[model samples]
Target chain A: MSPLSTLTPRTLKKPSPARSRLRGGARYAPTLATVGLFLAMFAVGAGMYPSFLSGQVFLNLFIDNTFLIVLAVGMTFVILTGGIDLSVGAVVALSMMVSATLLQQGWNAGAVIVLVLLIGGGLGLLMGLIIQYFDIQPFIVTLAGMFLARGLCYVISLDSIPVTEGFFTGMAQAQIPLSGDLFVSPGVLLALGIVAIAFFVLHHTRFGRTVYAIGGNEHSAMLMGLPVKSTKILVYALSGLCSAVAGILFSFYSLSGYSLAAQGMELDAIAAVVIGGTLLTGGTGYVLGSVVGVLVLGIVQTFIAYDGTLSSWWTKIVIGGLLLVFILLQRLFARKAG
Target chain B: MKSLLKHRLAWPVIALAALLLLNQIFRPDFLGLRMQDGHLYGSLIDIMRNGAPTILIALGMTLVIATRGIDLSVGAVVAIAGAASCAYIAASPDPGSPVTAATAVLIAVVAGLALGVWNGFLVSTIGVQPIIATLVLMTAGRGVAQLITGGQIISVSNDHYKSIGAGYLFTLPISILITAAVFALAAVLTRRTALGTLIEAVGINPVASRLAGLRARNIIWIVYIFSAVCAAIAGLMISSNVTAADANNAGLYIEMDAILAVVIGGTSLAGGRYTLVGTVVGAFIIQTLTTTVYTLGIPPEVTLVFKALVVITVCLLQAPKARNLLNRLKAAPKPAAKEAAKEKVAI
Candidate 1:
């Protein structure tokens, strides 16, 4: 029997509450915990600030975190396959730089968008191919890719490029009114659309299942005749595509491209994925959970901001603490499952 | 000679020599050194001085990576150590006193030890993956440093403290002497005793080693603490050099450079065998590369690309697949003869 199959109990036995809890809620415990935390934090915020409970305040959370949401969605796929893509942040910066530079040069906005997406996808594909063919560790390969992409960004320009194109600015300003004093921007809508597609693809597609299988056990997946190589590469490609879209959203939000933009964003995305109940070890997670994770992060930042006296650096410390807690929680569930 | 050529240190040593040669070609006086008022003065000395921090960190990283683990928080630890030390000294009534410097160093060392213990607990006791475990501190450490400094850069004007980084000892940079002493101590401790074998055994097969009565957890824990201490000292060197603790930029990306140094020195990230000498060479190579970049008139912003390119080249050269391919090519020209020779040797 394969090592993976050996992980499952072969003998029939009576189930205890602990065992049943391990079998049932273990997979969802982290997500459930995340939801509970978010709600509790929200309650605290609402209690602390009367204005924090408004529809506009919540809408602003989605709008502000749209870029992170999109990035996390892509990161979810990579993490699901037991791989990591540290190049996402660098790719985002590269895309922003490329898009801003092109738009500043009077290039068509549509063409620039397509080109940026292609660049991101191409870079991911290259890194994926290197990882697949050369059998290099994903961490090291992605680290190299991160360096390369960041270097390329500097090669393009060291200074921030302000995007003045009408299409870009208009997209930034475009908003859809929902209720009284509440509205959503195009970036938020795009983020939601990406999340929906990611959810559908992850849940309903053969490729997505293959990705999960690969993460669960690459050797077993290969023995089972899954398209491990292609799926692995495609997972990175999809992540790259998502990063590109997120980069465009970021540009639309900020209307400028700075080389220093999105520094440490990959860590943020990883934190969100972990917080949302997705296992960093891979195999069991949901894209939607990652969305919740992003929201949790956004809410924490919002709370800190609302406090009015806390330093912005507190957000990092809080997030780091949350990441540690969630990781320990995941470890507990994993131990119980085993 | 053939066996010597096959040694792992051969490549890094050769790479370092090649870089020095390149420097020499670019500037004939690159190798020139002179004594001025009892201290050596030259570009070579500068490389040794500047490379000291990296060498110290890489020495610790070598052991961590050898144990099938990594410490991503070392860079952050550097910041924390620097922040703590500098904060102490800056607040001291007499910052220039040796007592203040010694006390500050003690604070930094204690802070590093605490952080290392925390990391060790998370990885060994809690069974957290080393990367994620250290990453927690890596993320929060800078914030802690910022808090220590109250979100401001604290600069010190302590002559004694500055000498730790920039002072000369026996015509050598004090930083270089400190790094060498640490390296020699590590080399003796690991090699003279059974500790090296135990570390290797734990790295190669923890389960088997544990069953064989080795304290894998203790070994892992000690290595992390050692790494953190190394990072702390390196942090002191860095902050002392500049006489300022800018939490935001202190030790920024030094982890990457240290990791690269370890890998370039022929230490596999997968963990197993390691070489301290190779790590030292690797550190020098990296420092030399940075110096070379500036000497070549490359813009500071574009220098990272050059560094990346060189790292990629070195990594590709060291990869197992590339090595196998090269061996195959070497044998292909006389496959029949090579086969006969192999058969004879086997018989």
Candidate 2:
């Protein structure tokens, strides 16, 4: 103890400022690149369209993509643990279908929400258990889960069910006003709240650190006595819960639930997470980065919408190209780190 | 009998037979074959003909997965190939001419090869995850296809083009024949050469293989190109058969079917050790299962649920933990003396 006390302050001086800055630069480069890209794209949009720079338009980015924000947040937690959940889109659709069916049957909105979340989380928990115990690939397991959830959606009803529930309708139209007459939807606010919680849990909690440790190296994490199994399972469960919440938000946005709702949305969520600078190989990401990723996508949609002459298919092409660019950047960064 | 039970193809063969039996039980004509205009027409023929595109794609996928990579862009590649060919045919002055059809096929193949190269470059050279690399194309490929088709379903009535997918030659469906030729080519390339071993070696351990002087990157690149080409051919077969190129729906979800086929055929998703024969059986089983679902009339969409169950069951059967649990369940019914005997033998 005496030797440790003597050696502590002098011997344990912080790293050189230059070296620390270099380390920080490498760690935050992708995220900064994403933010710069988003800002650059916004600047281009604002220059092109007179109405693109409004507070409402900016807030609309958050409003229109509340569901995506939630889904990407969930995908972040799962991806951080080096696993993927392909079933999120399907689970969202399932949750919507279940909520819609229940609400139409005169069930309470609160109960419907709880039930749907339970279903989605149950599916995720099952998939995680099978993945952990049976040693199955997460991709295949989640693919099956995707199939199951989508099939269940069709089983619920072949048509779109209108959400006649007062609570959903009220929430859908509810606006939380900001300064200068700008307002955001309740769903957007809710999504933002989730993002904040996710940010905290990911940055500060022991559970969050454990997830990063597992993603960095499962074998080492195990040797280091980290609860890899439980964390992995919980990560998936958290993803499912978020997906369910996204489904509820989606139902609010559309005021209806259809079997085919959110088709290919899982890809969008994954794209957003990746664009946010999260490595697909897992670890080294931020929940806030994922939120920024969602904003980037939202802004792209806004850009496309503002340019009315452009077709909708261009959005896909642009997104695909952007994905390529970001993935290359990630590869370069990963190479540097390695 | 025990040897047959332990055979690799036993379950798939049995599954196929069971599906056929069920169909036969429901409708005796399910297995009936008739000759018309010197061409076979029957449920069995329909299964093979309809499943050709999937089988062809699966052949490519087998090699790709054997290299421990997946190409989700195959479906998108299919759509693109179909769109390019159909668009070309639609624009051609002599649309009905065989020359035009030949030109269209060339265009499709070239487009496929180009996309394949892009995927291969990203995956092998840049060292991106195969899934993510292919996903880039999967997302945007349909849009590109739509662009080529001008967002319209281009229907071509060229007999030459039609024959590529639906035409019969020597009492056989040209689609089935095309598939067979491709299958034979893959078999010869993989089995008659060291390429298969090389691919498997790369898949089994990329780092070790690289250290051992194997060109894992090149092998991966080649497999991706091969897969894209296969997907391109499948696209031709599908669009040509329908005489219409639907950029939107063409090859939609075919990748899932191909993956399921590969998995059901006993190919591990973890990669390494693949069997083409098992894949063929798997394709037939899937086609048969789809056909069976229609016959049973439980809403065609419900087949996805059944498909999910099958995937889980097959995976569980292959999983070590499940197998161990199954063994324990089997032993729990036996006397303690039998258990002791088994333990003694294991020791």
Clashing pairs in 2: none
State the lDDT of candidate 2 residue by residue for A106-184, as single tens digits: 9998899989889878888899889898988898899989989998998888899999889999999898889989999
Q: Candidate 1 residues B122-170, lDDT tens each?
A: 9899999999999899988888889898899999988888998989889
lDDT of 1 by residue, A39-116 (tens): 898888899899998888888889998989999999999999999998899899999999999998899999999999
DockQ of each model vs. true complex = 0.64, 0.76
- Can you give the lDDT of residue A169 in candidate 1? 98
Q: Which numbered prediction scores highest in lDDT against the true structure?
A: 2
lDDT of 2 at A115: 92
TM-score of chain A of 1: 0.94
* Candidate 1 chain A, run of 10 with poorest lDDT: A8-17
